[model samples]
Target: MNLLHANDRRGEYPASYYTASATPLAPFPMLKGQVETDICVVGAGYTGLSAALHLAEAGFRVVVLEAHRVGFGASGRNGGQVGSGQRLEQDQLEGMVGRTRARALWDMGEEAKTLVKDLIARHAMPVTFRPGIAHACYSQGEADHAKVMAEKLARDYDYDLVDPLPEGLIGSTAFKGGDIDRGAGHIHPLNYAIGLALAAVAAGVVIHERSEVHSISEGARQVVRTGEGQVVCDHVVLAGNGYLGRLEGRVAARVMPINNFIIATEPLGDLARTVLAEPVAACDTKFVVNYWRLSDDNRLLFGGGESYGYRFPDIVKTVRKPMLEIYPQLRDVKIDHAWGGTLAITMNRLPCFLHPRPGLWSVSGYSGHGVAMATLAGKLMAQAIGGQTGGFDLMASLPQARFPGGAALRWPLLVAAMTWYSLRDRLGL
Candidate 1:
């Protein structure tokens, strides 16, 4: 996949509302010469930068190489809803990994959310970090399921603040709400990623933007070769996610690249309150979740509607249709901007961490939950490298099955499969 070239906005920022309003930062020069470090990280997105920051804090020299600017990948251009747990349901997770291990994974998800907030506070990032994200459902049956799940979580896991919203409260003339999670929240993801990179650099990690790791040699010490330079290091980390090429065959085969898109509407001002009486981030339970939240500036940043193939539609039109379906009152609202990013997914919709070679590591395939999970995965890997093993091994031991077809045929196969599921979503299955 020509990932860098395929999604080119031509040095111009994506036509995203976030990009337009982003606070500017100084651009880093690309890697120009051969370099050496205690660890070399590929992909300067959340996972890579998080690993670099923690490893640097541990006094290990780290180098981060990116194909584009920081936040250029999915890390920068996401829907900005930071929620707990995996994309799959909690009961499904328990069924797959057993109760004890599933509970551990659930705890890890919570840790991921906390880690993001702590990182933001430490860097003083310019993002309106707020609490209370919700998952709204238009159907009463969905509401009932949400109540059961919330009760289960509270009873068994001692998790609190997961309250089910009755139809009267959330069910306006327009839409109904499902469940509220006080622990989940939203932030400007791009700002968070950029801030994290800045913090990593301040802590003595070298981050080279536009420095793609074209190839690598894995042995006792892994050498990551970029277009302009090489990073000779004791360990190599591939956190490239959907853009991870054939670097490690084992890791690459297990994860499939999936494209998801988001669009922002023109500022709704006070009218936005009419749609969502209380401003809370929300997602619907569907094969493709329709997620949206009020930006700090009050623009309704609605996200959902995915294209499984490495193909993107004219974003505004395709994404706006989905938004209108949920809130038809917004039919007259103008779409200000639209953008898309690719995320990696495994067969089980769980992330995979691997040690393909003794010193080579990769943590990716978060399905659609990469923002927080990626950060946590990076931190755990850092801990493992620093001689703390249990957490990282637990995460790594999670079952990860390869997609049915290899790269050449997987996209079409997934597109076909997801089309049927999306049909089911449309049919309210």
Candidate 2:
């Protein structure tokens, strides 16, 4: 099934809290005839929008083709946490790549966070960048490890934005302890995406919504075919992430799609303070992580539960179980909205950045950490297209392995693995 149309209505945003609160953009026209550009960016999420904006500013003609509305996928539907570092921790990265390259990745990760904030400031986006994300730990051992990692970051990386939270985060007694990263933060994800699209438009990037790319004929100049029209461009960026399907077999083999659900509770009024004494986001150390933060009007925006299949599970039922686990006091809270989105993941959880063919670039598989990294990925791709390939090359140099059974069997394999891990989480292993 086409994930783009499987769970959601065509040309409509999910009934998400972000959607309800965000300033809406008028829909762009669909591709109706042949169009030519310097670059054709497929998928108008953070990655495509960021790349298009940067390339347009650099004086390249750009066209962004979206299957649905801009930010209609995970970009708008995520938990909104702009995390620090790569999806893998710095130590893990050091083990995978060398210390020198690991440090460079760390710098890039830091730059990603800065880039998100800079985009917001530069564009004057209608979004607030709230600071601090607490990494809540379930066990004391896990808590100790977090403290150690924080220290390592300070000592080795000269980054001291993390602080130990021995009493746990978000006033939750279930967590033994944790560490808070002040440098990393959260935002209204959909609004940030809308902001990126606006910036891209202002920079002369043409966006065509509901223009799902059906195929690409590659050569010196590539032809990207949509339902109604086509785009012939010198370069093509595959930024569709989870909804990309098998548009490119190589990327599909490396990047597996998965579904995650989030729910918003009714405005808690004064009780919001009890849920989160401070307005910071917190995520626990579960195999299926539970993340939450207070919305602008004080509604609890909780994201949890995982689905392996293309169709979404009953989102409110799936997510509320975990939400209650984290905040049992919210047992009686009324759910205002619930939705799910597809996001891609690699075997190692590092983003897969590949120049699969000449004039064709694929960037996806951010695992659960794409908000900042994907934005940076876009900028790096634009830079590479402009003859400055250093940043993009560094990211593409990271090893990304294909799924053991390729695209066909990846879902079942991932389901089995995730089931095992989730069982361990339940058993407190």
Candidate 3:
């Protein structure tokens, strides 16, 4: 099943808390007949929209094609944690690529975070940026590791935004200890995405909602075709992420799409203090991680649970089991919204940035760290397309191993491996 249409209506955002709260943009006209542009970007999520906006500001004619409304995919429905560092930590990065390149990667991660904040401020977008993300450790060993990582980041990188919490994260006894990173934070994810879309439009980028790309014919000029129309452009950027499907084989080989669910509770009012003493977001050390933060209206927006298939499971029930595990006090609270979104992951959990062919670029497999990295990916792509390739080249050089078993059997293989890891999480192994 096409994940774009598997669990959702055509051209409609999921009935998410984000959709209920934020204002939506007037729909852009669908692509009809033919159009031409300097760059044709598929998918209107963070990566596509950011790339379009940057390229447009640089005076390039850009067109963004979206299968649904803007922010309709994972970009709108995630846990809203704008985290620091790459998907893998600095130590692991150092071991994988040398210390010099690892430090460069760390610097790029910091740049990604700064890009998000700067974009919001520069555009004066309606999104609110809240600071602090607490890492909740479930065991003493995990807590000690957190402390060590924090110290290593400080000593090696000369960056100090983490503080160890030996007693545990505030407002929950579920964790043995943790650490808070003031440099990392959260935001209204959907609003942030919509804001980027609006900024892209303001920069003279044309966006077509409901313009799902079916295929791309590459040559001296690339042709991106949709059901209703096509775009003949100088460059093609495959920014579709999980919803990208089989548009490019190279991206599909390394990036596997997976489903994750999130639920939002009714406004907690005074009881909100009992869930999070401060306004910081929190994520735990579970194989299938549990991430959460209090919404502006005092509702707990918690995300957990996993589904390997294209079809989403009962989102509320799937996520509630883990939500209650963290905050049983919320047992009686009403769940206002439950939703699932597809995000792509790679074998090594690092993003897959590929220049599969000349004038063709694909960026995905953020491995659940896309909020910041995806945005930066777009900017880097735009820079590369404009003849500056330093940042883009560094990211593209990162190792991206293809999934075993190719397309046909990768799903079943991933299911088996993920089930084992999740079982270990349950057995505390």
Candidate 4:
């Protein structure tokens, strides 16, 4: 089976609210002949697109080759929750690395949010920059944990605005109470990626869609060969996340592509107020997180299903039960769109950026924090290629362990582990 096209038919981007609202762009012409550039970036998602934009702004002759259309991957089809910090909590990260480096990573997360906002304003992209991402907890214990985290971030980190919400105020059936992270917010992810492409192209970056990079060879210069043409450049950026295949074995092994699904219900109208009572993106604290928010048009967009195999489940109704378990009031809601996309997840829940070779670089495995992490990663990659490797070294210091089994066996192992986690979530463990 043509897995890519089969998954594409699985409804990841089939007539959703995002697709309906996006400002469609003319198709980018595919690469047809040999080209030379100072830098050749693969994948046109957020990371590749952002890196291209920054490199062009730095006056590098950059060429971006994409396997599919721009924003056609997870960058365009994500939950749109631009969260702060890494997927792992601050304390966990600090424990893995020293406090000094951990703090720097935290700071980068903040910078990523700023970069996104700046890009949005600079491009004048059509996106709803709404505020207030209230993280919901399943129990009072988690809420208490959030409070402690808030205090630590405020005192030691010189960061504030992460306020703990008392249980009395968190009347949602899904959560008791949690922290309101002011730094966190939501966006139209597709619009953001497309906007970055627009800005990148405007800054003179050449982007060729449907030009899949099939092979690469390294020497004084790197050769990126696509199906239709080849690109010879001084530097190469491997920004293809889960779909990148085995382009760079080290980075690819560090991150396994897992499929996460979302379903958009028909418009809720006044019922939305009864459900959330406000316009705030929310996610529970379970290992397999349940995240949901109201669309601009009031349809509830809930994302919380995982499949180990590349293909999504035959019936997406399996996701509805879990979604309703969180928001029981939505038991009768009609699901209009059910789709899934692959996300790169790592062992420690932290994104990994590696310089596998002297002239070749890769940054992937954002876990579930791609919205902000991937955006910043692209910036750091630009710096790395421009002879400033400080930021890259700092980010690359994050702990990384090989998946328990090799590529073929890793998925089954992860599935077994996640099954246990799902059971724990059900048992309130």
Tens-digit lDDT track for model 4 on 240-353?
888887878887678888888788889998788766666778787888888878888888888887888866794358678777787788788888887777778889888888
Q: For each candidate, what is the lDDT?
A: 0.82, 0.93, 0.92, 0.83
Write out the backbone clash pairs for model 1.
none
After the best TM-score superposition of candidate 4, give how far the Cα of residue 268 lies from its true spot, in angstroms: 0.9
lDDT ranking, best first: 2, 3, 4, 1
Tens-place lDDT per residue, model 3, 1-429, is 898999999999999999999866899999999998899999999999999999999999999999999999989999889999898988899999999999998999999999999999999999988999999999999999999999999999988999986343467777889899999999998899999999999999999999999999988899999999999999998899999988899899999999999999999999898888889999999989999999989999999989999789999999999888888989999999999999999988988889998999889989999999999999999999999999889988987888999999999999999999999989987
On the 0 to 100 scale, the lDDT of residue 26 in model 1 is 76
* TM-scores, each model vs. reference: 0.96, 0.99, 0.99, 0.96
Query: Which residue runs does candidate 4 get wrong by more than 4 Å?
Result: 1-3, 9-15, 166-171
Roughly what TM-score does model 1 have, to 2 decimal places? 0.96
| Poorest 10 consecutive residues by lDDT, candidate 4 | 9-18
Every model: Cα RMSD to truth: 1.7, 0.9, 1.0, 1.9
lDDT of 1 by residue, 320-409 (tens): 877878778788888888888888888888889887767888898988888899999889989988899898899888888787788677
